[model samples]
Target: MTKPAPPGKAVREIVPGDSRWAELTHSDNHRFAIVPDRFVLPRKGHQVVAALQDAVDDRLEVSCRSGGHCGEDFIGAPRRNLVLDLCGLNRIAATDDGQRIRVEPGATVGEVQKALFRDWGTALPLGACSAVGMGGLVAGGGYGPLSRQLGLVADHLAAVEIAVVDEGRKVRAVTARADDDGELGELFWAHTGGGGGNFGIVTAYEFRSPAHLRSGGRILPKAAGGLNVQKIIYPWAMLDEATFATLVGRFFAWHEEHDRAGTPEASLFATFFLHHKSAQFLQLMVQSDADIDVGGAILAEFVAGLTEGTAVFGIPRGGLMTWLTGTRYMSQADCGDVMGARSASKSAYHRSAPTGDQLAVLYRHLTSDHPGQASYVMVNSYGGEINRRGSAATASPQRDSTAKSSWFTAWLDPAQDDLQIGWLRAAYEEFFAATGGVPVSGAATDGCYINYPDVDLKDARHNRSTATWHDLYYGANYERLRRAKRAWDPHDVFHHSLSIEL
Candidate 1:
């Protein structure tokens, strides 16, 4: 059974011409639309659940939006529907003992980091983009540079507070966890790696913080080394497919070897960014928390192997910026504000390394129709603790797949939407096909990364693979996610083109 929708008077008042309505309608990453009839930002979880129930009874489609970063039309859809904006519900509550932190779904990862840093020198292992909403990131199985040290963000989840729709236009507030409540735990597990806004509305998340260590009666010394950032840039035209493949493959191999050797260094993080243009270029960021010399030595060896007469140039170091506590929300806010202002991004994951021939094809495509903006393939290494956990232990289904890498192509020209999108899609499809469509099930490819959500894989118009799209993203857990969806949002009130289907 569930509680009925609250009376009309309880619903936040709104009129069609109001500024708030305009702001809400135009607020997501995909700015394009099917505007909603009304939008509400309930301050409390119970209030939101009640509103969702009422919207369901009215036969209105509901779209859950937080930070408006669900790429594509998930947040902007079906004009006469209702938009439940949870961004205003941001709140961070710590448990009495301080071992656990409870966060509202609307809270940004940056905010969480800030809160943790303020209370204690603690932080959650989340994506590098601070502006990403915690609700969506955790739900989609978050991974970042720190992932090598802490595993997926979902690994630390303790519980989730969600609003489930049930029994004839009613909603129930349920606390789902792994212990003391197995049914609810399953729901929590599903949400951990399952795509966002598909099952139910998650209002809050409870996570266990790492324990603090002390020496004798005093706290252990603060970490000694400063942050070091190394930048490596290579001209795009100079890099052919073979060079790119060698660069990516060698990096992955190095990361794997280091992980097996049990060498964990907080200062170690590597990323490769490609810019698509006449002067196409590759930029790599090597971040280390160790002594600059030691970090440089390790990085130099890796870079030397890749740059051996390959036209690789520019090895500069960006000095450490201030080390802030808690999630870097201010930084992410800048991204959201920019994305909100106007931006488009597309992403994909690889299950296997691109072969030499496939690389040639990719190089041709990237150089042929290069967009003026900084368009390039960004690769981050996943080693250390990331591989220590079994794939099934968390909702991130890609754990078992050999697709040890994820890549993205991002640029900032709103006017070039069609051209840019088409280029990305075509290149991605060609790459996937050449690699045996590793992202599709039954192909050597395991699944796609939920964080880099691509609607094409599921759209019959674009993807013709025999493998069902959902299986590639959720693996064997797709069925379980469906069951939970049936249990919580049976009517499929919360839906988008590529969201989990019941």
Candidate 2:
């Protein structure tokens, strides 16, 4: 029999036939699901420690879930059936000095933002997805619209609390602070971009911007004013192959010039959503936290340049809104409940603009007559303050990349999985055909983002890149991460498919 949980903490057991079992096994990408031998939910850190101890005693493989947004099957292990649902541990609060904020793993990015703004009138540069949990996002080096101005969400980390098992097989909780010495310091650095669910199960994180320290507590960084957002759409019917390619080149050229470290234009952030030809239209969204007029002018200038020769379907307008309100506007698209649709995503990091040949391949795929599948390639502007830090400063080494691109597709039918999955993979493979079927760390591209995990990196059939998956994701920091993993999780209690190996 399994040991009982500590006092004041309850552990609910879920069997295969229970109604909750089906729901619990489901993940963000319904493409993969697993029926575990045991399932438990812990509401607090001590309970998590107790659960890990129990798992160790029984020699059971374990895994954890926060927001369940993993695009791959990392959260779903076939033999590892011991899963911990942390939703019950949701909590958010600010430190007494008003400089650092403490957030629980279960708390969504939306929840953390609201709490930070409400308690201290400050915010962190996190992903736009409202439902992404702090656990995976922060550990994977999160970035969003504000990242160009401030930096990665991981750059602001002050400390982290995690649960692990010791060599003697005893359950224990450890806190690793940025100011700590030796192993603790390494542990903290590993979480900066090493990716979550590797070293241990994270319980809480403390974050504070470096600019806050520079100000001597007078003012926070990049939050002095509100934000201005501009959303523009162009019907695909109006965009011929030449015009689409022209606009794409123009967009790339503009970002190459503006998204430099310490430049005034660095405050301007934009994302070009190029949907498949079947979607009927392409959308370009720009956001700036600067003065409304300055932001509007910048947006207007960029839009004007992109559509100089071609006729734009609808000339969009710029609107000014508070940070909270702007986030609400951005979050509107994903406001609904988490659907159980099968999903797949592939990501790439580019140091320069896409080559003419690459753009042509994209056009061919978008216009191809394939199954009516829903998919899109999102090109998000990267670099600015994010590039000021050197590769060795954090586990995230893609600091020099100018753009982060992701190919995402979703559907409800299992029968069409091959058609949709093949479409996504073919596009990615063709894009990096020059680099042996992957984005190798070089002048044109700098590997892929760890946050956008892709298991294909480990498969020889798909990953033809000369560099290994660790090199693509961690660059020179892979050894450091592996060492830290060996030190903290020698028992390999917390791990997944792409986890750091001892």
Candidate 3:
């Protein structure tokens, strides 16, 4: 592990041979990582501005990295870019009134959760993976198991402090808040779900709970009764074609029926992980904040809906644990572990369940021969309190979506890259053939999640849909985000392949 740089200051230098330099260049995804000429480690907000100014003065390209868990190569510049390493800015503190919390961009979700719960007995609806940095996650409309009841992490954002490049390419630190009257408020709106490394380098974020939500033991949602999680596994070998189809159909139908803002089942969240046929099993994990009495009932009802003709291998019950303990367990550490693997992913915000043909396509591809070593189709319940707000309320416009489907496949060796990537692409295209090879925003498909950040949407070959990249990602909110970008980052200092185009 790299030691923390000194506090209340920043460090900028070139370390082409340092072990940490090599490690920092690469992230959770090994598919991309172009080395930079220098690494700028900023310890504080002022230091972040100074580092940006230095990079601009040197005429070097710039990028920022917090947790380095991005699926794309936003931080992995392909040229002599100056990368701002923000890991040294980890800080979490609350306002004097205790109603708002200030979190530095480098603070991971785990750190934020622990601090919020320990200090105030409250929590934020952040990503399930603790390793995820607040910079990208919150900016990309983060959510976790608690999202169904609490809503997206971005919904809680009160203000954001960012260092942007001015017209002369000089660095300027600007604070945008939700309550700001003019352009500053719009700038803050863009950060709600504009995706990271786009508008500027964010140094810190302030999160505030709504007045109505101030009474709960936990700021976001009540976990006083404890949480119950259940994992049900069904071996694919035991599942006949009918059983498989029925299970998938039932899972989709359940969400369609109950995925409203407030409902009895709204607190119950479930995820279906459908691995390749060769993997021989599908897993459905469900969790709820309800206590043992109603928790068991909720889990039983959800399982019963999908077990019509299916034979399950086992249904393991997860023990009850306090909100803090359960959160600690849910924070995944595998995000940045290995870096040699190559993978391709595609995401969709489903407004409706998959059609019969779509389901058939998924089944055929899962069982087909493919070079990819591991592949899975994960469908997570979306909507609930997340949809309580309107599409234009934030930069993330997939509020009406009831479910999110993610198609992913991974493999080792550059030799298998084409095969694995091709396999995932084919699967996604076929699944949405009715939508012109992409999940176009409409009655059935409400576009894709920006957090997933699929560059494939930019290519005409992959996105045959009438809607373009901006349309699918931002919907009607694209123009607003564009304005924010032009105003704050006229020179387009912070950018990526799929960033908000000027």
- Tell me the whole-model lDDT of each prediction, alpha carbons only: 0.64, 0.81, 0.80
> Residue 392 deviation, candidate 2, in Å?
1.0
Clashes found in each candidate (C-alpha, N, C closer than 3 A): 14, 0, 0
Global Cα lDDT for candidate 1 = 0.64
Clash pairs detected, candidate 3: none
Q: Candidate 3: minimum summed lDDT over ten consecutive residues — where?
A: 330-339
Ranking by lDDT: 2, 3, 1
Query: How much does candidate 1 score in TM-score?
Result: 0.85
Cα lDDT tens digits, model 2, 86-109, are 887788876677656778999988
In model 2, what is the error at residue 225, expressed in angstroms? 3.2
TM-score of each: 0.85, 0.94, 0.94
- Name the lDDT of candidate 2: 0.81
Q: Please write out the lDDT profile of model 3 over residues 1-502, one tens digit for every residue.
A: 3444557444645467766677776777878865877777777788888878877898778888898878877776546577888988899997677656889989998888888877776777877778888888999988887787778888888889999887888788999988997889898999999889878889999888655545644344434456667777887777766677888888888888888876768877788988888777788877777543364577677778788644644556466667777666544456331345777788999888887888888888988886433688989988899999899988898888788887887676778778888888999988888888999987899888888888988898988888999999899999999888898889887778889989
lDDT of 3 at 292: 37
